[model samples]
Target: MSDSNTTVFTNPSSFILLGIPGLEVAHIWISIPFCAMYAIAVLGNFTILLIVRMETSLHAPMYYFLCRLAVIDLVLSTVTLPKMLSIFWFNSREIDFSACFTQLYFIHCFTVIETGILVALAFDRYVAICNPLRYSTILTNRVVAKIGMAVLLRGSLLTLPRPFLETRWPYCRTNVIAHTYCEHIAVVKLACADIRFSSYYGLLVIFLVTGPDVSFITFSYIQILRAIFSLPTKDARLKTFGTCGSHLCVILAFYIPALFSIFTHQYGHNVPLHFHVITANMYLLLPPMLNPIIYGVRTKQIRDRLLHLLTHKGT
Candidate 1:
């Protein structure tokens, strides 16, 4: 273990993140709202998961993907919010190097997995909309299960290297992380050794995991749009668009902030550290909160079922 006295300023064992300016003072003010958001996010996604599991009508491929999405949202939220809430309520902001890397690993892993699942979902929509006749045969339970497995495996493999690389570096100096949650790049920046290899590997993983997935999703949507436009009835087109609108909203909610965060981290780090911290929280917290709402409000079936489920318990 490296001691603080011997460590260079740049190669400290840990960093002291300044956190959001005034966050310490605002902790009380923000805790209630943050807790509310966390509760809503968990409950909303859990409700969707439960509904999908219990409702026989939702046994189709679409709902299967939705259930998987709910699981992802639950996990994504759990990984970040609990820690953040702890910090706010208890003022326990300190994290060790190993724990930080562990958190970073899962955060990146789940983020990539969700992206892959979204791609799979886009393809599912394309098949359902563009080739409705063969949809059932093409996206059967077995195939969906396989795709789910693949998504998990790919995400795990891609993100595994990040933590491994981080562990190999010696931490001799700072320990304070600026953000509430442990982020992979931020953790990497604290390493005492050279991180050129880590950065290169990170770039490669990003391209391999997210780049192609987004491209495939875009392609699937393009094909879906083409097929929708070719339909004879306007009602059919409108219905199809409506079905996909929720998913598109979710995809945008998840990816746009991610892309913006990437851009800012790469180019805008000089702007203001607080700006980056806010964006990081937005990236981590917003998707899980928004996903259930997008699906619930957009899909009448889900909305009606949720309502029934909520109301029927009292009777």
Candidate 2:
């Protein structure tokens, strides 16, 4: 990298985040829903973690993955919200360059982690459905530990360069981010320098990690569907449907907002800027709120456990 690339900016070192431009009058109003969303996300994910920890029967590979998902969702929700809440509730929008890049790094990390997690959860379902006899043997506690470590390593390694690359870019324009949070493309677009390299690499990272993970998960579900159709009994099919449906709901929630944000940001040139910004917020906040509800409502095991915990507490 050229020294010019890495040279400290003589201009303001801090950036102002314009939270929903032209919606200034509505920020306080907007924050009510945003605050509600964060509360639901945290309470929901935290309950998942607590149930998974408290219920002995829920310690299987599926629940283990669910537990990790809750952790990631909680972290993802946290990383952007505190700053965002400040912006919405207190009009505190300025963030130092280092803090902006740090937020970007963590947001990227959470994306990778969530993608890896969905893949893992899909694999867990595939094993349970297609090869029930061997599910326990294949995904032993040791194997689960190894998988957890691998996902963490993968998420951290692939995204670590993003902040450095973004930081080295020479910035000279108005130091204002369009959205509430520090996302890779959002930050990269602010640089006075060309960002083609950074943009392509961001796409490459998505392709290398998330694209493959989503593909494998989709393929796994296809095989699982085939296995389900071959089941001899209707109850067997319904039982499988309940499990797969909840997982698919989570997958859709996580991916749809993600794809919407990516497509609109890339190809939806005619799309309004606020639409993209709102979609970005949805991309970060929706899954954390929805994942627990989907599981809690659809999964018999979790619902039963919640009931059991509640009934005992009432007694």
Candidate 3:
């Protein structure tokens, strides 16, 4: 609130990112694991993309959705982790105003994109399992392309307003963000003006994006479960249910941490600052690291193809 601490203009020249508040002393130690996770995520996601692109038989709606998810994961992590690591390793905390806003937009936008893609994946399973006979017809290349476009547009357009809305506010308060990246709430809280509209819009974005996506995913799975159970043979039921296992794991890995991070940011006043930073980082890192591993391990086709690729390279 002090004028001396405030920026004179609407936007500050740059914002300082405090990597992790209480854990600053341990930053080097922390970056070790964070760097490892980043490496794994990068390698795993690229492998998924490569394998899916190379294998002709894997060119179906399901794999196409997986490829989309991989790209989202890569972008999601890349947007945040490198900057976070820079802060941790080199104590490089200053980010230009425009660069920070760009990071903020990409982080939220891709998060929503990931959420939408999860719903698409759920729907792919629903059609594949519940309506096996019509899977190919219902989810043709054209239809899949349309769904991908819709998901991309929905995320990009919805989050486009965030940076603009932020720029409208004059940041008269301190410009130090206490988390790794330019998180929306963290950055906006530094504004001197009334932030009620921004707050409400944030909640609205969640409700509009996450609310419907979660509902659709749940509905799709219910139908999938019903179809699996109705199969005539136990073997058929088990075999069919097995197909959804990787997706289920992926959904849990993605949403559980994400929802935790969101709710904690909204309401967990008593929680430690380090807890928040760690949770936020985890939500971004864990899914990207785990998603490809989950699919590679659980999906036989991908696993075999991955093995074949490795073997061929080795030979």
Best lDDT among the predictions, by candidate number: 3
Q: Give the winner by TM-score.
A: 3
User: Candidate 1 residues 182-256, lDDT tens each?
Assistant: 876666666678888888998899779777988899899999999989989999899888889998999999989
Work out the TM-score per prediction: 0.92, 0.94, 0.96
lDDT of each: 0.81, 0.87, 0.91
Task: Compose the digit string of candidate 2's lDDT tens values, residues 45-72.
Answer: 8999999888888899989989999999
Residue 241 Cα positional deviation in candidate 2, in Å, after optimal superposition: 2.1
Candidate 3 lDDT, 151-217, residue by residue in tens: 9999999988867888777886677888899988788888888888877887889889988998999
Question: After TM-score superposition, what is the CA distance of residue 238 in candidate 3 from its true location, in Å?
Answer: 0.9
Deviation (Å) of 74 in candidate 2: 0.6
